[model samples]
Target: MRLWVCIALLSTVLCASAERPRIVQGMIRAGQFVRDAAGGTRDMYRAYKDMREANYRGADKYFHARGNYDAARRGPGGAWAARVISDARENWQSRVSGRGAEDTRADQEANRWGRSGGDPNRYRPRGLPSKYYTRDDLHLLWLCRSAVAWPGTMRLWVCIALLSTVLCASAERPRIVQGMIRAGQFVRDAAGGTRDMYRAYKDMREANYRGADKYFHARGNYDAARRGPGGAWAARVISDARENWQSRVSGRGAEDTRADQEANRWGRSGGDPNRYRPRGLPSKY
Candidate 1:
């Protein structure tokens, strides 16, 4: 009778141990996923900023061009008789305005979910049910489920307590994957914005170039018509304007060359320019 009772008790203990939930492994896997996701989120943010900087630099060139063009149009002689230069200046102004608007929109979109109100703890994990689980609660639940497995084993108690402490602590932390998803969205929006802004900048640059060409052509004709009375003065003004335009164009061409080189390097490495540092002008520029 005594032997049978001992065997029955041992069997019951074994069955209870078998039924205990194995949460430590699951918690470990989840923690690893969270760490990886957090790291990826950091990378995404860096990439977004780099892309934005590239777009800003590209847009800035056109802005300088527009400024130079406007100054040339409003030169010392006041307004010229050529209506074409005036019209071209107006068109360039419109393009510059449009580019400015697009740039503002892109900046807003990129910072949509950024931290606000100077709250440092805004991103810190809060162990709430809706936000995350509490370690104490998870520990108690796990203990309740496995309490019957080894009621009198001190070693089992010690092991369970340690495991519960570690696993529950890990599980109760904020899910980094959530923040990673938000970062991923930011990256997507930034990439799209960068592409749009780059295209707009290129279009504006080309349009400004065409307008400059027209302005120069019209100025040449005007200078030719006024060649009798003050031809020397007109020739000097036109020459100055030509030199200014050429200088601006040459500077812009150099910038474009650098950008193309960066693009080529990125392509050779099979990396996205938006995601990595390209060998070009500093972003602060």
Candidate 2:
């Protein structure tokens, strides 16, 4: 009986010893999680504060993306914190701030993009002070250095096309172009996109085909958005205006109007338009 008792005590001691490391590891992990989550919250606040201080127009989306990206980089805990904070902020803005659903949706999209590790520079506005960015950010724009020598509209198109491609791809080199309209060529690209929208409208009017309306809507938006940020801006403006007008004046039901808007958004976001192309639609469009 004495030997059995000793053996039992020894077994209990061995079990406790074996469990100690696991308990210690779990505690360490829990502490790290709390710290990372706290860091993430700080990251979000810092981004928001920097954006307010920067006070640059059209840069809100960029900041939103940047903040989420910074937070998510910390690890799983950081990502969870970011999502919670972002969702709460968005909910408050949408409900209390009276922001439109579309605006709120766009903000969330930017948030998701950042948290997904996408480059926040995708939404960076032109002429935002270089000081707001790191050396790495500036280096990204430097990829277009090759376009500096090109002249005329040719330069603008070449650089913008290259910019769009590089912006979409992993990385590539492109030269700078001269005679480019200022405002980061935003004005020119927007004008071109507007023209595309107008041309699409004119063509649709001339065709007057009943069933092919959706096709024209998508085509116009796709072409406009293909022009770049300016084009995308123009397309969005036109699409919203047209949808609102039709919903109020054309007597189209809300559902139909929403469907039209969906197609418009789809094209603007670079979705293939042929998906909306109706059977027997002319090849010309």
Candidate 3:
């Protein structure tokens, strides 16, 4: 499925290239040739031969189709065709033979792998795929060739290059914005968790205070009611109550300390505190 999608994308790009200026299209084709040569995927020399033959036929047709002397005189033929073909061949050779920066880097990486007794062919670039080449690179090569093929297209090439650069930058802006959004969400989630934990600690403290107040009031009544034969029993009850109150206070204090420590740990780690929230706990609380 992924392979099919890639093929579809490449096809779409090629179709789009057709709509580009003639010089750009030529550059794209030339770039393709260079890429094929580097990857050893196709017989580029044969492909070039075919391209030359096709161009020759096209030129011949254009010259003979119209019998007008003035049109034939104005048409690019003979010397012009020879120069364009020769320059394109040279460009193709230079690009395919590791003359460009990318090609040079690829060669260096391959050499490193070879020296390490590894399969150099298996080494791929960091960002790009092993066989991947950009349309922009191809377009530049086409532009170079176009300068030789038809010098008049140089100004148009500059315009297209500028426009494409802007478009490429705009295309990349969304990814940068997406990264910012993800970072914002992470910060917001961390803050929310901290707030929730603080609220939980507040509720626990309030509940502990209320229980402590009730126990103290009950102990006071017991102390006042102590009398006669039941004095020992009342004393025992008072002692147990005091012990129970102390235990509760100690337990609550420990729990509060633990909760605070946990919250602090989460805050430092940039973790979501709400992940430890008790079930059935109200969000407002």
- Tens-digit per-residue lDDT, 120-181, candidate 1: 12222333122122222233445445445645786466445444433433212345533432
Q: How should the candidates be ordered by TM-score, best one leading?
A: 2, 3, 1
TM-score of each model, in listed order: 0.17, 0.42, 0.18
Q: Write the per-residue lDDT of candidate 3 for residues 103-166, one digit (tens) a residue.
A: 4344334333322323211332233221221222233334434435545666566445433432
Query: By descending lDDT, how would the candidates be arranged?
Result: 2, 3, 1
lDDT of each: 0.35, 0.73, 0.36
Candidate 1 minimal-lDDT segment of 10 residues: 112-121
TM-score (C-alpha, index-matched) for candidate 1: 0.17
Per-residue lDDT tens digits of candidate 2, residues 31-60? 567777998898888879879999988889
* lDDT accuracy of residue 139 in candidate 1: 38
Worst 10 residues of 3 by lDDT: 63-72
Q: Which stretches of candidate 1 lie over 4 Å from their true place?
A: 1-173, 205-285
Model 3: per-residue Cα lDDT at residue 181: 30
Using lDDT as the measure, the top candidate is: 2
How does candidate 3 fare on TM-score? 0.18
Whose lDDT is higher: candidate 1's or candidate 3's? 3
